[model samples]
Target: MGETNVKLASINPDAQKARDLLRIVIVGHVDHGKSTLVGRLFHDTGSLPDGKYESIKAMCERRGVPFEYAFLMDALQAERDQGITIDTSQIWFKTEARDYTIIDAPGHKEFLKNMITGAAQSDAALLIIDAAEGVREQSRRHGYLLHLMGVRQVAVAVNKMDLVGYEQEQFDLIEEEYRDYLRSIGVEPTFVIPVSAREGDNIANGSKSMPWYKGPTVVKALDSFLPNAPLVDQALRFPVQDVYKFDQRRIIAGRIESGRLKVGDTLMFSPSNKTAKVQTIESWSAREDFTPPSEAAAGQSVGITLDEQIFVERGELISHVEEAPIETEVFKARLFWLGHEPLTAGKSYKLKLGTFDTPVTVQKVDRIIDTSDLSNSESEQVERNQVAEVTIRSRRMLALDEFTSNGRTGRFVLVDKYDIAGGGIISMEGYADQRAMIMATKSTNITRVEHGVSIEERARRNGHKGGVLWFTGLSGAGKSTLAVALEKLLFEKGYNSYVLDGDNVRHGLNANLGFSPEDRAENIRRVGETAALFQRAGMLAITSFISPYRSDRDRARAAAGDGFHEIYVKADVETCKQRDPKGLYKKAIAGEIKEFTGISAPYEEPDSPNLVIDTAETPLEECLETLVNYVERNFRV
Candidate 1:
């Protein structure tokens, strides 16, 4: 960072027009000389502030200590005393090719989350490895995270080569091993060079001691990184950061996250589903009055006024309406856990994406990924520092784009209580019709069917009112037996009815689903939608399933809308074990089954069921009579 680029940019007006800029992050393990390398880069570029170098050198001389180059980045006196970098610090430097912003991230395990924050914002990265230590755990973990964040350009610096006697053989071994690991994670290193940051070899100049090794200096390698292509060809996604009203006009303010914004372009705000035309652009300046620029590209901060007054607010994404974001309550994401507590299903966290924040729950954990070798396995939870593919459900609707499509609107962070517990990227969308598929039908302009035969007519012909009776209980609780008996009794009475058995559906409609909690919820979802279809044809839909979770059952009821009956065909664990005809209870008790609800996992009892039949005590005839009488009273129109 020269004095001109660091402090005298305004005075040198010509330099401001040079828009070639790139941001890169320096990451590595603790005590691996990341700060030293950044300090060396700044020193060699003459970017340090005036008197900054002399003061540091004088301090080292007075203390009778060798001046440490890493001290330049560890600004805190306590940090220098402790010999570690605590937080991410941004330092500006320039090469003739481009202006560079280097984000020096802490390499400590505790601050790995902080490192993610900086890496997520970078266009490229420099991974520094210690030659003496070879490849460390963080060397792989950090590289994996960089790949996860979509940073493909990387340059690895093998530092502290002087400590290894500047041996070419030592550099080759370390270089080959680390390069192979990068290939496994789908990253081809732009360059890997051995350097001694402390001795200033292979940094800004060539090294004579290691004449056998030949490669571009670290500065040249960084310059070789390609600049980010212009995002103008992409769609506009200017997320609203805030709305400000200085005196009279309300200005929607935020950085253009991607694409471009210009006056007179029609824009639509997402999640809010509001639209307005951009009337004028506004920018702040030192002058009393200034002309607003005609356009604002990505990375520029500008405000705009709409032609007509609208309820514009934060958390709303701005884009062209024709290519709007997907507003949904459910999505799939790959998340990296960082909280003290492991990420568990059913627990709630706050998710913040762009300017939007909402309550989030890990509805299902598909699998946990081992960062070291990229192997994956089925996991019930993701522990701290672990990565996993999971399904997340939000309390309210959020407009999101897949990270493969748009990086800014596709990223999110999970906050457990007040601290950020994890971060993820949106991968797949669910409930695409609206926030919730069942709820969106009420808002859409979908043309309602005008059937030639009315629902009343169909019920009259069938001699019964349309309804759904959901039977839930523990396995071997006689739910299916009772449902079969009810179907016979109802059919004998000449009333239209049908039965949906759990295992029967799994054999066909839900054949692709597994026994995972997520699959179970989806199974119930499919059954609920199917049962509703039967009710639409004036039939009594009797569904027999364990239906473990109350949340899943509630969604079923909500989808049914009305005439939804929740009957708990209750039985104690011991009684179900005694009556285990299929022997599932024996397997579950012997630990042969995974995610076996009511034995291994959970079975949320309904708070207020329409009916409860304790099959262990209630007589078969008595239970049948109770259900028959209840149905006649409710559905005998």
Candidate 2:
């Protein structure tokens, strides 16, 4: 029972597996008694390892220090003497209502990242204010932080009541000041109860010392915290972590961030645009006799074997075919800067959102908010511990959702050098984030590119409507073949058209790019923008790429403006392998190539396409006729 180096209490398996488990984090300023409150909760709930409490008490006695509940949180005697938690720690505690995992977050401003790490993973938070100290700067800062991290349910614990002689007046004053600041930031506390974490008064049970108080005890208040809204109701967002090829079975392992996934479900990977059907629902110890789960919902780490082995890699987001996340590079975010240096505009930092890690720059400092006093104003740069609204421009397009849409996938961190310097929740698309590129285009246009040619003018001049014919599907799915043959048909028929074949375009235009998720996004972006320019000049830009990610295809459609048609060249894996004109699927199957689409990587089919040509079934002449006829009826006179 005497567990040493215990991060979590050994709880009953039944309690551990309960669906009512809630993750609550204790956060506040240094020496404000966050650890002590949590330690008291654990000890009172009978959650501590046997003799662990007594050992801490004995150590405090031998060192001539008073035995405090806070002592149980600090591993080293020096840490307790210093009266500050240096790192984040988690402890398991159960109550009459539900089980809890209380995260102890350090309160020191320097350890802000540690606190943020804890707060980010939490469902709710208990913000502590030292009654004796009477509303310090860190108290206001932490409270404001909890709001930014989207911890909606916060209760203020007016700790150290014994030091204030258990006076109700002292508790009232501190609660009033903190409550006003919290209101300014749009947060209302659930409760502001006075407590002495050291003496364990008003903790598990109500305090008799404060006879005027008639509210719930610490335990009662904590038990009132509601369980988080289940992510099953939302759209799916599973970012691939790693692909495991153990023996002959290739399993894509990841946690479902939102929605549910079932066997035989069709999944589309974003930014890569790869498609696969769930062949099997796999767990770590899954066997032939394994009873498949009905469906793996949000928060479950699962390994899924696809019907077709499409090269899915880390950074690609798996989504439902009907619904997909947005893909963009420029977005607005509300971030709290924790870097030692100020977050200055024009400086590049690595922005990690889900599996997408790309170098990003602070294009504009919209404004900065000082959490210390809730004072906000427009600023040129964001300093340490200051929250700010800024425009971020990533090096490549990233699949993303608004924080309000999905917190797990919607938040990102800014890495300066090697350390994670800032964290933020994406607010919305920063259309202004494209300012730098726009200004550059303006500056470099010796020919003075103009938007004088209207859509109608372009269409009339082209003889056929000017637009993009975007062929998307797996490699060797006849996308390039169809696009080339279609271009030949249109050319001989005396209409302005050109084929931007994936291979030929890559050789010249995207020679610097590779097949990674980031590179693929950039490659598509360039092709899309280039196709748009060609379309504007009244030419039908027929572009063919695997373009497996829906989000990327959507972005390409966006760039091409109106009349961008998506064509799905349908072919199953076996058919595509048999027609492996490039010998890529064979190499990928043999493990000679990594992240190769249609074999190891994913090829997401168009969720809804203008046309679906079964290349495996239809003859080349018939496929050509169907494709050309559709284009003529839709785009021709």
Candidate 3:
């Protein structure tokens, strides 16, 4: 073991306060010793509990699992059983200079979603490359993801030195190759360490096996890391996370993305376009008019009290009044697709960027770039784990910042109706006009075929204004029956209502659609758009479908906009079979209908639905009453 040195001057108590904590995530191909390296570091620093190692070792032996360094990182039982890291495991350790939180990210390609979640929160990354195997697919994939996530700092660790006979030549060759690869993607490693994590060589202690190489140990290199300061010192960016109202005072809790914020400063809330003066800087401790923004820079969570009771919500940005935020409906972004399904033009998905969640569609498949070849591929779609430069058009305006400027506001994820399928970074903002121009060029002939009445006027004539009532459930479930029943009931009550059933739309509106995942997506998209139009016309639109995919439901919600109401007619598959509204379940089980939802295809229940009616338990009258009350509360007369 190398002699440990303590530099008291290097350890500053105010160091943690000076800037946001720099998070470094360790990512690499599986079995490359990422977890082992972390465990070794923890073990050397005395961070792990006393009997934890012994217990893990005993468990590994009993399970007949190969006791590698990665076993220490198998925190989850699933990870251990699968012999892979399924999720990112956060571990905190203290060095002589700073307190570091190391995120151990999984390297499996299937778990890229987990990797993105971990990398998004990191300021820096540690790329672990196995010297024996060189760079694998995950190593390259994660590298691209990190770059897309705006992680500026990176370090490379060449593990398994003992297997390579602790040869300096092998380490040098691998280092040069990886350096070239990273440099191509605009990332330069700070340091590369060659050490045997199994033998405790040069990780925390200096290794005698490799005497020719002379460089700082991994721990020393980490301590030497200096955080990058924010660019604009005068510009304050506060992204409101939540509003807390206690008694008579309203407190806004958010992290300052950039610049200085102080009490008595006038701040402007965007999207809502409201202005208010800062009353006081509220935190665990009460501060006066002198709240130094420098004292709490970007990424540091803080609370603020405003002078006026202005309406604000999570995802809204509050900044200095002079530099009001820009909101746009369309933008150009660099996207990395991770879903099993490919990303195609005209496909809709839920766009979750910052705190704003909206319905978005891919207007065009701009260009697909192969990360490995660095060449353009002329393809109609982007497949799983592929990186591409594409343009996205959102239904509503979103306040966005460039990836180079502010990562917090620039990064976004595309949820396939329910599951997050892709992650992207906003490269350019305010591309709505460009998209409009493209749309104009595509439409050679323009014809005015007005319905002769405005949507508001039509709704007024209908008695009850237009809105979308989405019904979701299992295949054999009474979603369609209930939807039709409700529409008839609304019609009898002097409300104009229309039913958009799966069977009805398949005959004409969705005639081109098939039972495939892609076709199902298109089916949902068409229904959602139609419902939106009906709602605009002031007619109640009831859509009933076995929209098994959550992503499809999310897209419908976004298309329907503010008046969209999602109702989950919750019923078990067994109960659905008992109902057998269309005799579809029997066909599905008898192999007559392939890709039938609730049989072959999956049905993801809505996570945050507006209403949930258990058709199995609730009476028809009671369910109808509950739905009526919801409509009355949500839709104003």
For residues 366-473, could you state the per-residue lDDT of candidate 2 as single tens digits?
778877766669877888988998878676767788888898888999999888999989875313122122222434536845678787886776677788899888
Q: What ranges in model 3 sit over 4 Å off?
A: 1-21, 54-68, 230-234, 242-260, 280-305, 429-637
Comparing 1 with 2 on lDDT, the higher-scoring candidate is 1
The numbered model that scores best in TM-score is: 1
TM-score of each: 0.75, 0.67, 0.61
**TM-score (C-alpha, index-matched) for candidate 1:** 0.75
Q: What 10-residue stretch in candidate 3 is worst by lDDT?
A: 3-12
- Which whole-number lDDT from 0 to 100 does residue 425 have in model 1? 85
For lDDT, the strongest prediction is 1
Residue range 47-160, candidate 1, lDDT tens digits: 788898898899889989899899788888877888888788998888767889999998998888988988888999999999999998889999888888878999999999
The models' CA-based lDDT, in order, is 0.84, 0.81, 0.76
Cα error of candidate 3 at position 316, Å: 1.6
